[model samples]
Target: MVDEVKETTVHELIASPFVGAYLVLRPGSPRGLKIPRDKYLQLGRKAADDVCPAWLVEATRRCWNLDISGRGVNDAVVVRTESPYGYGRASYGLNLGCNYDREHCYSTSA
Candidate 1:
């Protein structure tokens, strides 16, 4: 049987509350990112303290390279999980700081 795939944006992917790490499928590569939360943040910003994995280097292209060549890196993202299944494990909530503007810092389900 064929595996079910769902379409979602990278922003949504990072925000997904997956219970355990899930596989990320992309052209030319398919890997899972299961680093610690701190290291995951570093990977998000492309800042690695030590040598970065050769596959990890493509995180940027895979996340935001939404070029219109019908081949944008992000255009190919797909996950098997149709719904978030964890207790907000991947949730990155707003800063909700008093100093930050409330309007900009607040998150909406929209």
Candidate 2:
């Protein structure tokens, strides 16, 4: 039998501990060479299953499916979620590789 999917709101998904943990694992910016297609698929599936946000899952799926090279997993997520306020908020607090420099850190203003 097919399992019924439970509906979850953006707020609820963001509030979920699972989503929080998943976001912590995701990169907020590009940091390395592109992830291999096979690896991206594997990681994406794992992330989709672990997170409560439907949008994040979908974004992971679509980003991994792209043919572009040199894009890291976190870069994919950042590119996909940077727009549209809701998705952006869902991905907030991500480690964007600029946390050390006060002038460049997103949390700080120039």
Candidate 3:
């Protein structure tokens, strides 16, 4: 008999309502994020205070880099250009005042 194993991904984890909402409510969001709500909360240990959000974003950006060679760090992740849009700005609490009307502001999805 052979034992079967299963692999889990960040997207699968962030699909739950709890995890989804937490990520959405986070400061810097990705492009098309899809994960379990409970799992997302577990990874961030509280969506309000995610430490290495950029690191996660960077991983996704790497995929894009494989296609576009000259994109450079600028094309790494949406967070790199999401400050102006209010997607990468979590320090403003949860009031939803972001306009997202500039190249600087962008969103990256996992």
Candidate 4:
């Protein structure tokens, strides 16, 4: 029998990182984030069970890349996107590498 599925919010979805390293680079992360293992596991299991849509999973995975470093997990990601107001969204993407095109080789905010 399928387990009863609970609806998770975008914030909750945003918070789950430690279920397993199926995609996330960090192990023991979900628990580390203080998310209950059972819940995290349940969520992961649900995702695996196809109750969660594949495109959503893939899209979410593709949307961001977590940066795990010696300093520990850097969940700070910055993405450049336009808001409905036409102003750029302040943040929401993974910061990867440096922009050589720019004069200063600063870390990419996103």
On TM-score, the leading prediction is 1
Across 1-110, the per-residue lDDT of candidate 1 in tens digits comes to 99989975542223121445433323333333453444444434442234443444455346545222323223233223225335432222322225443443465647
Model 4 lDDT per residue over 1-110, tens place: 99999984222123333212122222323321233444334444442223433433444455443322211111221112223444322111223443455422354776
- Model 4 scores a C-alpha lDDT of 0.31
Candidate 1: residue pairs that collide = none
Off by over 4 Å in 2: 1-51, 66-102, 105-110
lDDT, candidate 2, equals 0.34
Per-residue CA lDDT of model 3 for 1-110, tens digit only, reads: 99988863222112123211333222234333443444344443533333434434454455322232233321222221123333432323233465664333354534
TM-score of each: 0.23, 0.19, 0.21, 0.19
Which tens-of-lDDT digit does each residue in 1-110 have in candidate 2? 99999984321111112221223223333322333334334444444224223444454446543232333333333222223322334322354333453432344544
Model 1 worst lDDT window (10 residues):
66-75
Please provide the root mean square deviation of candidate 2 (C-alpha atoms, Å).
13.7
* lDDT of each candidate versus the true structure: 0.37, 0.34, 0.34, 0.31
In model 4, how large is the Cα lDDT of residue 54?
Answer: 40
Q: What is the lDDT for 31 in model 2? A: 22
Number of the candidate with higher lDDT, 1 or 2: 1
Point to the candidate with the largest lDDT.
Answer: 1
Off by over 4 Å in 1: 1-17, 23-48, 66-86, 90-110
What's the C-alpha lDDT at position 103 in model 3?
34
Would you give me the overall lDDT of model 1? 0.37
